[model samples]
Target: MPHRRCSLWLVSALIVPLAAGCDDSAGHDPADDLPADAAAADRGSDVSPADAAAADSGRDGWIDGDGPDASGDPPAADAGTSSSDEDGGVDAGPTLDCGARTECAGRCVDLATDGAHCGACEAACDASEVCLEGACTAGPVEAWTVDFDFGGGESALVEDFAVDAEGNLYVVGTGRAAPYRTLPGSRAGGFVERWDTDGTLGFRQVMPHLEATGASPLGVAAGEAGRYYVIGSTVGAYPFDATHASAPEDRGYVAAYDAHHAIEWLITTDLVASRQLERHGDRLYAVMRGQEANAFPIELEGVRFTTDDGIGFDWFTIALTTAGAVRWGHGSDTDDRANGLAVLADHVVRAGYHTIATGGGLSSHRYQLDALDHDGTTLDGYDDFGVPGGSAVAEGGGVVYVAANGPDGWVLQRYIDRTLDWERALGEAVHVSDVVVDARGRAYLGGTLSGAHSFDGEHLGEEHDGWVAAFDAEGGLRWVDIVDNPAGSLWVVMKEVEVSLASGLVYYRYRVTSRDGERVVALRQPE
Candidate 1:
């Protein structure tokens, strides 16, 4: 964990010299000695001097004052002002007494209430927030929340979600029984729903279980002009198209839906499960996995990949036009699991973990990041001693961000031009669920934390909590918000996170575990 020096201007006035244990080498400004009212006002409440001092006691490198200055003697009350110079000559002029105001950028401003300079100079609050008690307070407001009912013996497990350019949200998941308002007789099936920006349910399409084995939609990606794609697996015949029926064996599928929720085209293969889908330009990329023997002559359109002996499971990546025309297909021979897919302007990146035979029938798991050219050729590859989790690519394909379970803990890495730029260890026992990068190259990660963990300089206690964090382009920790578990809930898990480019709001889906099973909640955090 990296230690960040506490900003000097934010410290209280009653502290002794060494008690400000942080690096004090920076020149001290007169604004450091703010009046007691400013301290109380910053907290939005009245407090005694001792109480104000105690408020920062738990902060890193902050301690109670007990001794004098370096000269072994206490300084005068008005230490910021001196009548004479250090050489004992006449002073330049008398100092100004702004009374209750701090001098910031050559102006007397109330630090406690100034939104542009809250707590310290230039510490501005967000547009939707106000400065209170010297701190930026308010939202990241929850714009809205919507809940779904599984009805009867059915339960919902959100597989993936996406937000289109028009701010409409699309969610895809699996339900054990029929969803609310839907016709009954379905045992287990997959569902897709669209919600308007204002939380109105635009449309809900439920694909019921037609066979003994169920149907599950694992991934979704929004395309241009009000179109979207979903990739998943079905154990029986094709559910969307009757003329395209298949065998009882598991089959992977990719279905395209138009603006009016009408199926434009549907494609299927013997590839078992397609776990992730990504859209770039007019093309769609999907990653699928299946046992070699189960999918011997795996075929998608005219593209094909064959295996011998059908020993272990293999993963494949297929590129196709939005009209369901397969462009190319690439497959891995080893035992690997695909976790995520990110499409850039010129290429696509696949993130997952690969198992290697370490002799004596033992194996080792290594994180794998492979960059494939737009034409489905391997352009570059990276592998390390970890388990790859999720990945996101910045705009223009110039940078990439990946999250993995490293040897020591959870780690987030930044890659530029297919090269490792930097890696940051999140903390011990942090389970990262998803990662997404905005247009400005900022990365947002959501997950759950257990035990004690330090994110940048912020410390979380032993209790479990869900967290959403933002980092800059250079991998610097910007800020983290913890979603505490509610009462009567055992724990919380963040399943997915998506950043709406049109609205700049971050939407995250979380599940709360209680005595009655798990409940799903979706919240959009305002910027």
Candidate 2:
């Protein structure tokens, strides 16, 4: 959701086998189902993107582009198809021709905007109303879309959106429309909007200091209660490489909002514009592009919000540029730097890829994940799984699910505690960036396929479009679904998935990384 300078990590306290960090011998468990790659292949292709879209669309009730947790018994298909379904073998729902019928939840309806399913399916809202999270109540999809009026080819562009537990939807992006209104040619009228689930528009306020018309909110995570966090960069804040200015003034922003759609707190950091935001309880976590300051973070500080306001929150700093371990600070990266963190109930898992060696300059190594305290205390005995793509840590069924995307997907392992007892790889290396787990102990991953797509026009489509493979509880290979019929990046790249326990909706979002085209899909899977 935002970008920043880099550098952070602590490989180990003491050195043993020292593969990377953590105690590999303690909790490593062999993949339960099929190997990552083979698991994808072995599963037959009985399901399609339609099946996944319908039955297992969301675990909770409503689904957005943020989470992915769905379960259903689907008819058998190509073994490769099983690789894509997270629940493995079973009939999830009835397969429908996506192009013909607009799929929402699990039922197929007419696409000609109805009173039930507005955009697709039996999903029709009132006359002028659009569908938000199924139900066909009232109002538009998001606050941002209703507030801004573009007046160009399209009214506006909705880059990112997130919904809270109160059934209120929050969206931030560029443009100006009614309800989602922006000042006339105000140039920098960048804004964030929040809408109630009943289709009532809440707040539509504008943010100051955005560079141009390009800066838009990318990733978003809802916090405890109705709090919201957004991340994205300004078009030309400081302008690093000449053409704009001398010093890197182009900075990114991570802001917090209260339930009533008000800025509770915010800060500007010089992170490269990226779309990735994750909330660890009350605090928000992101992989921003900031300047590589000192070796570690001075402290884990944020804002103080009593009621839609910041009450003198401390201004702390950390220089986590590379890949090293830290107690209360950031670290340095090897070649380039990158770090990913996710929150579990009791622990916050921080992981890094292509980690370099520290000190007297030892040989360099790649890939490792570490669990740390919410206050920045590195947990003990980590190191059982080897990941390539970014990693995601989640808790369901009383077990913690740590899914990391790697080159193809050879390096992957699950854990119950610090000791990793099982570890295994699919060996194909498809590069699954993140993973999500359900209450029934199922894993769903999303990312791009390396050689899977080719760039044409502004869209990225593949011969088959990036595939989503499903793995069994023990890491057995399940089914894999080839998304999208046209093969464009439209439905291929699953940037994120939101799984809500109460709502039972699994929202999966995908779009062209090139920032072209508009595609929004919502489906409900039958329990």
Candidate 3:
């Protein structure tokens, strides 16, 4: 049978205090829970004469006078009240008090374990809900989540994501497709899928081109009128000769997909690697990393290439019209690569890190951010942000916010007019993986943390959990919430975080592992 409801009620009441149990064990032994005859059978002795005489009068062998008769039945009435020794017969046992205000879906149920009223009332779970590790989660999670191992049993990784104006999600990743388009280990192709606002799968497609080695979709951006673009580097020919560059074996590609999921256009470039892409107005700006300057031709308009003598790489930005026409480009010979990009009304910002020659003939990296004018010229640049491993950029309330991860911790910087306004760190030693800035100038940060950490005076417990915190424009923390895993399990790691501008809902994706197995979960923060 299922775990006894009595045990569940006992544990739930002890933890939450929503219910209370009757304490009838002050003078009772653990053996009192067993039946009288069963207890006697374990004694290996017949009932004594005195005990039999007492049972004949009004009691059984039980110490209390409220046990069953020798025949396992309640005793007859002696006066206005009856003397009985049965579990539920003639007041033989005391009543249990579960609490006075337990309610769920208009029915009395345990909130700690009830699927229909987990954590709060009316928060019904559509699928199976299990209270594992002190938190309630529904199986086969539906919303704000995409599990790569859901059905195909293939190992996959989510690379890039884009959210549309209507709160829909577009995700691209690399993995072997199933049933429809199957590729072997080294020949895996890129896959893209869209999720509607209600968490339903809209469509799924695998890139038709196959690479001899592999390909990964590194960036995605949503544009006007529901259109979107997918960009990545390919290891083999892309099949479309008209769009591929002279040497198609190793190149980067940018493909546009219409609102109806139809392929509109495809283009290839000599750039060997592409990291990120951002759409502004009627144009797209892509950060491309190249190894040799000779690989790019000067005749290609809006296309600039720079190289560090083939010893290091050059990072640059290429602007292209919606119709795949190059507009403007800028290149730099620094030993760095751009990781993030954001466009504003008057300036375009790129955030990344560069390797610098240090003392002792060594080299170290430093974070860099540059503001470029419309003509692809650097108007201003800042390089004192520290060494960053990954970064993201956003604009809100005319202020630009850049969140990055470094050796120290997570650093968030706010800038106005290419000048620093303020900067803050999450804590002394924690990893902040991703951040999102809403239109109201509210910043949300997500990462992994251990031990007790305080954010803006809000205390998080001394446990390993996924943490998401919100802060106002003035760098004041608003709230911090923890998404804990099962006890004794490894700490939770955040993979992605995004907020829907249209719904004001914050979505985060995290992964956790326990003795039971591994799980990738997507959860929404309650308002």
Candidate 4:
């Protein structure tokens, strides 16, 4: 049935604790968490009947008590789990009206206007509350709300999501409507959806229009201030002419949106958009996947933005200088997908994932974190952050935090730009997807959690909640908020997490269905 909750507890309490005890006394170093059953069998110990049963029952029978703790191979590095894994509406429901039968943050407050419970179940409220512009009230809104149902079956995978200084939630996902499930009036869109920071359903459009009628908006990036940008391949339409999009095919596409969710302009080039999008300074970069015609590595490009009247059109391509036109092409890594990139202290930090040997017994793909010049040319410094694959990085003070899925499970690790500082394992269960750090140095990690970690960052806080988990700069976990079950799978988790400094709230663009309806709960740092 559903991964037995009893089994989950056993792994945590009985198993993990006993394993830790064995490590201390035996003085034997693990090649990183060799299953208890396997380790014990190697020791040739006497096993009880029930113990053998447990081992057999857990982890595909790879359990010490049951079997050799099944699915081994250094914990299947969670890769592109296409397989795995709400919101603000248009003012259609009643005003401040909620059912009292629902269970909330320890009380039966009205789901509507109850300062404590805004939308639905168990979403508790803090003490002194205030109402902002969302579907709920304020008081440091923990509002993470999203509605994901682009018409069923066809799922929208948000590669990256972020919010502007104005509190607008920008989500970048790949799906279709024409053949799949498009919006009501749209032909069938392969576009991005932009929601107001206050959870309003105002802005939605085809991310990047195509001229050849072939491509769609591929990659997207957002800045800390008021700018939003996306990259793709398409000889798309210009702001002046909707009729212009029916021409030819464009490669490296770049589109700019202002704080009001209005498109400024659209520019098309020649970059096969493979990964997502990233931004450092004023420079916007999009990394294309696949090899080039010359049999070289992948391609990379960046474009600069300038405003033309209210609509931002006309900008220079950063990959080359427009003055006299010089071919100062960008660089790429051995890996196909663009792992991540960041700008710190005038030094541009770029990272990618590569598969290599580690400790002989275990060899897998980890991350490559590097520092380059502002022009995206000069390589300053970099290293393998011990994570099996390249990941998103954030630099503050002297430490840089990376969110990655490595040899272990999920990790929100910190490095000193040069040295590997620390990596506190977030989920003792699965892998982590994205990591972000705030101006206050508070670190937030988004991934699938088997259970919640203690707010004090000690042990597994609760057996509930699998998806959203947050940790501090010191690697201490703050909270783990459960989203919902997918179909019949309870372990189904949330992926991308976008935090807003303006409201001190976190927004996860992934979709989760509750009882009566779908919701995106904005979980706050508990007070």
Per-residue lDDT tens digits for candidate 1, residues 1-527, read 01111111100111122123321110011111221111111001000111011112111111122211211111111101101121322232454345566655555666665566778877887754545557776534344444433111224455678878766677776552322222233343466655555444444444545434334566788888878898877665544532343455546678887765456887766675554788877888887765547545656677775433343366777788888899877776433343567787778887756667899999776667666888877875444324634333333225677887755777888777677778888876687877888777778888887765656554453356777777777777665656776677666666677776454356776655642222223333323
Top candidate, metric lDDT: 1
lDDT, model 3, position 117: 54
Q: Write the per-residue lDDT of candidate 3 for residues 1-527, one digit (tens) a residue.
A: 00101111000111111101111000101112221211211111111111111223222111112332222211211111101112222232344323532443334445443444555666554433333222465321222333444323333445667777766677665542321212222233355655555444444444322324234466788877868887776554443222332234445677787665445776665565454777777778777665555454322344443322433246666677777777676665532243467777777877766667788999876666766776676775444455646566766656788887677766888877877788888765556766667777777777777666656453543456676766778887655556665566676666666666563345565555442112222333322
Clashes of each: 4, 150, 2, 40
Off by over 4 Å in 3: 1-144, 150-153, 176-178, 181-188, 208-215, 240-247, 292-302, 305-312, 333-339, 381-391, 404-409, 461-464, 485-490, 513-527
Tens-digit per-residue lDDT, 1-527, candidate 2: 10101101000011111112211110001112211211111011101122222333232211111222222212111111000112222334575444544555554444443335544444434442333333443221221112122112332334456656643556555432222122232233234544333233344433322223233454566666666777655444322111222123434555565554434554454444344455544445554433445122222234211111121121111212111111233332411122334555666555555445577877456655545555645567566556444555544544555665465553446667666645555334244545666566555555555544422122233432444444446764333333443422232455544333333333444444333323323322211
Query: What's the distance in Å from true for residue 219, model 2?
Result: 3.4
Q: Which residue pairs show backbone clashes in model 1?
A: 42-133, 42-134, 43-133, 154-177
Ranking by TM-score: 1, 3, 4, 2
Candidate 4 lDDT over 269-355, as tens digits, reads 443454445565555544443324323322323333221122212111233221112223344343433245555556556556655
TM-score of each: 0.68, 0.51, 0.64, 0.58
Q: Deviation in angstroms for 96 in model 3?
A: 50
Instruction: Give candidate 2's error at residue 163 in angstroms.
Output: 5.1
How many clashes in candidate 4?
Answer: 40
Highest-TM-score candidate: 1
